[model samples]
Structures are given as structure tokens and as C-alpha cells.
Target: MPQNIVVSQPEDLTVAWAQRVVKLHEPHTLVTQVDLVSVEVGTTTRIRLAVTYHAETALPRRWFVKLPSLAWRARFITALPQLLETEIRFYQELAKAVPIALPVCLAAQSRWGLGSILVLADIEEHGALPGEPHDVLSAAQAGLVVDGLARFHARFWHQHGTVPRYRWLAGRVRQVEDHLGTVLAVPLMQQGLRRSGAAVPVGLHQAALHYARNRRRAMRFLSALPQTLVHHDCHPGNLFWQQHQAGLLDWQLVRIGEGVSDVAYFLATALEPEQRRLCETGLLARYAQQLHSHGITDVDSGQLNGRYRAHLVYAFEAMVVTLAVGDMMPTASNLELIRRTATAVEDLDAFAALPI
Candidate 1:
């Protein structure tokens, strides 16, 4: 019943390439309607179900099934399967090493290779969420998120020094920085950014022209550092705080990189420094201490925190993104990031005066 849902088959169950996953994940549900909820529906294909369950008793929870974008929606060399695989691995790996309380992943499949399918416990709807956007998280809400990141990062303090794959993700940011000017000439990213709130700054408007060149410079710095498995995007939207437990979503972006990357990016872009400073050190120390508890005593909190401060590159990226994405549908925490990054780029002249 949703506006743009493509129902390619007359049989009712299978629709285009999405049938395999639909029948695979939930065979019983008589799916009556589906909605594509995310703002970036075009980049890849996704469907959200509103089903009529055949169960007798009231179900204890709700689950959502996600598969690779529809055939016409495929982009970027079919990385969707690998994307799901890495996500499953991240949760499996993180749970084993760190023991953080995360939503139980019910089932995941990479049968389609780069075109993956996943059926995960829908934590937000089950746990009770507003299902809307806002500007700030209360103090307790923020604590729930930072504590999880703190604990999540703590486990990898041992064995893995720095993850190669993670460093590659950070480098991709430069690609965004690089072909930006050329790509901005296109509309998808431009449309998304224009609506995200934080606008592109004037001086850095042209910096994206040299993205490939700057990427080498930026990643060379990240590559020389210590590393571990990190939940790189630990912002509020990806974190869910329920009554008894908290959960993290969208692990597709997980990577092994500097401890500083998550810390700085989270602090700089998710919370206002002034507000985050209150509990930032304490939360960070807690993360380090958690690492020590796991026997990775060699990890230094001061060094970790120091590098985190230096890795504010994303802060610059966030400022410019506001222009392309429009109002960013910011969460409360993201609002702080936008305000702080704007001041840093304008008042402190950080990105404006950078020696590129």
C-alpha cells in the first residue's frame, strides 16, 4: 500500500528480487503492506513490513527483514552482501570479546553474496521509542550511549593493534571530500546534504576538489597509529536505551581503527564539547579501565584521549555536510555536534585555515 513499493509478481508473495529474502526470513507472515522508511531509499533498496501474524498468543517482540536494494537500486559494485557479512561479524566478534549487552541478532544471510539479507530483532519498536526525530538526549539518555561505546571499545584493547579495514573506511571520507566538487555537480548527495542542516563552508567548498590528494594526507596520519575494533558510528541514532538494557544498531559501518577516531567523532559530532566534557573524561576513563579489566593494561587513556582530540577531521566534514543535506533531521546529540563544529570551522578557523 505504500507509495513507491515495487510489486513485480502477481503471486503476491514474491516481488522482484526481494522475494527470496521475504520467504527466507519470514515464511509464515502474510505480509499485507510494506514501507521504505529511511530517507536515503534511493541509494539502496529496503522494505519495512506491517504484517498480519498467524500466531495464537501475543508475540513477545517484533522483527524486521532487510535485504539488498531492489535490482534497479543496486549501486557501488554489489557491496551489500559483504556489508551485511561484516555487520554480522562485528556483532559476533564484539559480543565474544567485550561482553556488551546488545540486541540479539536473530538471523542473517549472505546467500546473495554482495546482495545480502538480514532479519534482526527490531529493538526500537519492541523496546518502545518515539519513532520521531528531536534535538537533544537527556543526560541519562546520553549516558546510556557513551557507556556502551566506552564498553564496546574496551574489548579490542587486546590482540588487535589497529585494523586495516577500519583505516580504509576513514580514508573513504576523503573520497567524499575529493570527488565532492565533481559529485556535487550531481544531485543525490547534494539533495541529501541540502536537507541535513549544516551547510558547506565557503572556503572548504573547493577543498573537495583535491579529495584524493587530501585523502592520502589524512589516512597516512591515521595509518601510523594504534588500532582496535571500534563502533565508528556510536551516535545516539545507532544506540537504543531501553528500561533494562541498551542496544546498538547499524553495525555495517564498524571498523578497526584508532580509539581516537570514535572518541573524537562521537564527542565532536554527537555531543556539544561543553556538555560532553562533563562526563567525557569519566566515560573515557571507564572505557580504559574496562580495557584494563580485560587485561589490556598497555592501553593508555591519556594517549587515547589526546589522539581523539587531534582526530577532529570529521568535525570539518560534518560542517560542510549540513549544506548538502539540508537540516540533517538532527537528533539532540547531533545538534550539539552541528553547533560545535560550526563554531570550530568559523570561529576557530580550523578547517578554513587548514594547510591542505
Candidate 2:
């Protein structure tokens, strides 16, 4: 494949380039015209392409292309090579092995200074829809997501030490610790805190402030727990759903950590307060049952409950830091995530449960 075929902009997606990429999946098809259906820019750029194939050729009408964002903020944030590398590697190496539903990567590539590009099958064409950050998940939707997560975590559970192939997935906690100072200093942090302050309990807010000072110690404690492959960024915006089926997107933050982090983060950030309060215990129980069915018998409800609480602090800090440094445009969603996560922390007494 020619390197020039990899593009950073929609204009660069010529018909020839489109054909080359589509041919990787459909050899006999010829794309006549490539229309730019939609463009969504964030930490990454998502371009939807509507292709007109030659008559009698069998090819999908639409495909989704993911490339590094051209926006100054997005490019600056994703400039960290590992951030793009992780997602590219996930699609290239691990996406097939995982049992959970995720987008099918038709093609993907990552270059150090140049941006990354991922061509994926359009799940939207098949009834899957990306989740909105501000929208809350109902009980049924949350259950589907939890079930998918259980399968994903169980597949890679306890494999970190034994599998050399997974060595790349470690060090997520350390990475967060290293970047905490810069993240805290971003101007959006104060604004986000202020916007959501009323909904955040005093104890939880105090814990967040204190946790900032001792983040290293807190991360160290969590890292010492049993490890498994986690979709470290499992909040609402990174998820997709269709009826009973839930699909996860954005593999950039995938890492080795306590699997319950995904559970805690997803439930706390994605569900409304009353809905979360009603469904949380039952969901946790359901997850435990799924884990057991998948042959992970060492963890019981008590251990999961404790770890889940501790992880609520981790999830809260992560959301705050991410909102602090990343796209501050979604202020409402950022505030909701912070407020809901803080509520979970208070409800669970997560700060007290932390080893620090």
C-alpha cells in the first residue's frame, strides 16, 4: 500500500485511494464516486463516506473513516504517540480476539509524526448508533452494555503476567500519574468543577481535591489489585447501541487494570442518578454471575463490591482530568459526568475505601 493513500483530510480521499482501501475488503468492487457524507471532529476525526460502486459490483454504499483530528486542540492532545498507537494496535492485533462487539476495522495505520488512519465498517448502516454523552442509559441499555463488558474483561482476565503479547497494555495508571499535573492546570478544570459543584457532595469534592495531591499513591494502590484488560474509557460517548446489543468504540484508552473500573465508570457516568441507584446492585450481581460463567471463580460479590467502590474514585478523577484537558466544548456533558461520578463516589464512600 502506498503511504500517500493514507489521508489526513476528506479532500485527500480521492476515488483511487478509496478504491485501494475498499479493495482490501472487497477485491472486485470499483468505487466511482466518493461523497463526503459527514465529518465529525473530536480527539479523532470521523468521516463518513458514501461510495457509488460500479453497476453489478457488490460493495457497501457507506463506510466510516477515522483519522487523526485536524483541530489544533485534538491534534495537540493526541500528539502523544502511545495514545494513537494503542488504538491502532488494538484494531490490528486484539480486536478479532475479543468476544465483545466492536467496529470491524477494514484497514488501519499509525505513523509517528503523521496522524493515524482507521477505515472501519459503518455500524450505523446496520442500525448501531453512537451514544450521546449527555444522554442517560435506561436500565435495559445499561444491562446490555454491562453484559458486553463482562465478556470483554473475562476474555483477557488475569492474562497480563502470563501473556507476553499483552505487555503493551500495562502502565495505564503510571501514564495517568505522569500527566496529572498538566491536566490539573488546564483552565477548564475549574470551570467544570464550578459548573457541577452543586450536584457534587462536599465529601466527594474534598476527596477529589485531596486525591489530586496524592494521585500517585492512589494510582499505586489501584495498580496493585488484580489486573485484566479494560476498556479504560467506557463512558457514554464511547459506546454504541442497537436494541439489546451494545458496542464499544474508541480503543485509545484500552489498558491493563482492574476490570471493575469499566463497570464503575460506565454505570456512574452513563446512567441517571435514580436509574443508577435502582440498577447498580443488580447490575453488579449480573456482572459477577457472567464472570463466574466465563470461568473466573476467584472473585466474589464482596471483593467486587469493595473494588468497585475504590474504582469509583479512579473513574471520577479520570473524568475530571479528561474534561480538564480535552475538548471543553461539551461543557454540559463534562459537568454531568463529573457530577454523576462524584455522586457515585459519595454514595459508595470511595474516598475512604481508597488505600491512601
Candidate 3:
């Protein structure tokens, strides 16, 4: 068996490491040179590399790698739950079976005391355009994403009776994250709201703060519905656009939850208010229809609509909390997401829908 190799910094992407990774997957291939192409630092450090082989082979020359955040604050926030570790597990265990478009995982590994590392065949090299947080999707583009998510959710719809691997997705790590979010929610919401200023309407402030105060209860209410594997964080920046389909990325937040929550998060963060108003009703109907097509016939339209409205609260809170956790994303993009999700909450009366 190959030894555990965890990469903690840019300097650690050595040719020897590349050779080891290649050997694990393709025994005959020998990696000759590993050139650093670019580095993007945020919630995680994304490094792109151009590789050379000793002999001609069909393997990809360009690779996209994910390591833990280089920033201390982002690292601190993510380390407690081992977010990157969750992502590595997803790529290792679930990526192959799920019928969604995603980058091919080349190698994924994590060590106990050290961090995790993921190497993927660069989707850009495969002719896909990555979406950005600030990029608003058109109604047509939003439909594609919705359809893709429907298929993904249907695959694991109410899959609680499944194998142990799928069940491992929501264990100790997620519980720690939940506890941390609950303990810190009120303060974070307050800070985020203050930072938001006119971006968040004054009328919604009390409702948002109230939800924050009672977040634990609200979370239970949201999770009361049918459970399925959810992308959890379905923001535009974590998606990529191929010719006609949208691919999911950043599986750090994947978990078991209501499927419509993914739909709500995506529409809230990916669409502008005006566009969302025009597209949302149709997109939701389409999502339901797709689920039905996948033989998930038990979903009721009325209940799905209600759950969608109720779930918008989390979408709003997610953006606000992202703003609170400074340096996780670009400021302008974070604020814009806040504005969009706040609009979604107000427009849907999401706070009123919450059981809290």
C-alpha cells in the first residue's frame, strides 16, 4: 500500500510526491517535472500544476490541488471540523457513484495529525468554466443547476438504510460544527448584520437575529423533513459550467439533509433578486418534476414549496455568517451574496416559515 502523504504548503508539492501519487493510480507512469502554475488562497489554498512525464501517457498534464487554507483565520475556522478532510472522504467514497458532473479526483489522502490533500484533473483543462461567487446566473443557467441537483439528491433520497460508508458522512465532525455554529451564531449574525448596513433591510434584522438566537431549534425544524445527501454549500463559486450542464465542486459542506435546502441555497446565492423572481417558481417546479422522473414519487408539491421557503432562512444565515467569518471570501462578493439571500428571505417570508 502507498504511504499516507499530506501536503501542508505550496513548497510541499514536490516531484517526488507527484511521482508517488501517479504510481498509486498508474503504476507504469513516471512523473518527471511538477511546475507550479498558479496559486489561489482563500478558505482553501488551490494550486494548479503543470506536470511532465518521463514517457508519453494519456494522463492529464494539468492538475488542480486543494490544501487547507494558508490564512490563519480561515484555517482556524475550518480545522475544528476538518472540512477538507470531509471533502477528501467524499471524493474517495462517493464521487464515483453520484451521477453529477465533477472533476475527476486523481488522488485524495489525509493523515491524522497533518492535513488533507486532493489532486484533481483540472476541469478547466477539460473545457469547463468555473463559476464565481459574484457571477449571477441567468434563468436558463439556473435551470441546468437545479436539474443537476435534482438528479444528485434523488440518488441518495432517504438513503439512511444504506451502507456504512454513506452513513459515515454525518458523524462527530458535523456535530462539532453544529455545536460551534449554535454557540457563535448570535454574535456572528449581529456582526454580519452590522457590517451589512443598508444591504440588509431594517425590517428583517429582528427576525434574522431571533433566528440566530434560536438556531439550534430552527436547525432541528429544517432537518425534520426527509433526508438525502446534500451539497449543503451550493453557492455559484462552488460550481462549474460545462457546455450544457453545471458541475458541483467544494464538497466540504456535504451532509445528509433536506434536498430542497440545496435548491434554496443555490437560487438564493446564484440568482439576482429580479432574475430569481422571474425564474424561481419555474425552476422549483422543474426540480420537483425531475425528482419525480427519478422515481422519487413521494414528494408533495405543497410540502416541497413550504420546505423551500423555510429553508431560505439558512441560505440567508449562511451568507451573513460568511461575511462574519472574514477572509473566507472576497468582501464585495460576500456582501452581494448577503444582499441576494436577504432579499430571498424577505421575499419568501422565510423567517415566518421557520418553526422558531
| Number of the predicted model whose TM-score against the real structure is largest | 3
The clash count of every prediction, one per candidate, is: 28, 0, 0
Worst 10 residues of 3 by lDDT: 160-169
lDDT of each: 0.48, 0.77, 0.91
Q: TM-score-based ranking, best first?
A: 3, 2, 1
Q: Model 2, residue 215: what's the lDDT? A: 69
User: Would you give me the overall lDDT of model 2?
Assistant: 0.77
TM-score of 2: 0.90
Q: What is the lDDT of candidate 1?
A: 0.48
Cα lDDT tens digits for candidate 2, 1-356:
44444677788877998888877767888889989889877777779988788876555667888877767765665665456667888898889988888987877887656667888878787788888877798899888888888888899988988998888676663375357444543343454455565756655555666666676677778767756889888888888877668888888878888888899999999998788999999999999998888988888799888888888887777667656556622767777888888888888788888766
Off-target runs (Cα >4 Å) in candidate 1 are 1-46, 56-61, 69-85, 88-98, 112-114, 128-135, 161-213, 277-282, 318-337, 344-356
Cα displacement (angstroms), candidate 3, residue 209, comes to 1.0
Question: Which stretches of candidate 3 lie above 4 Å from their native place?
Answer: none
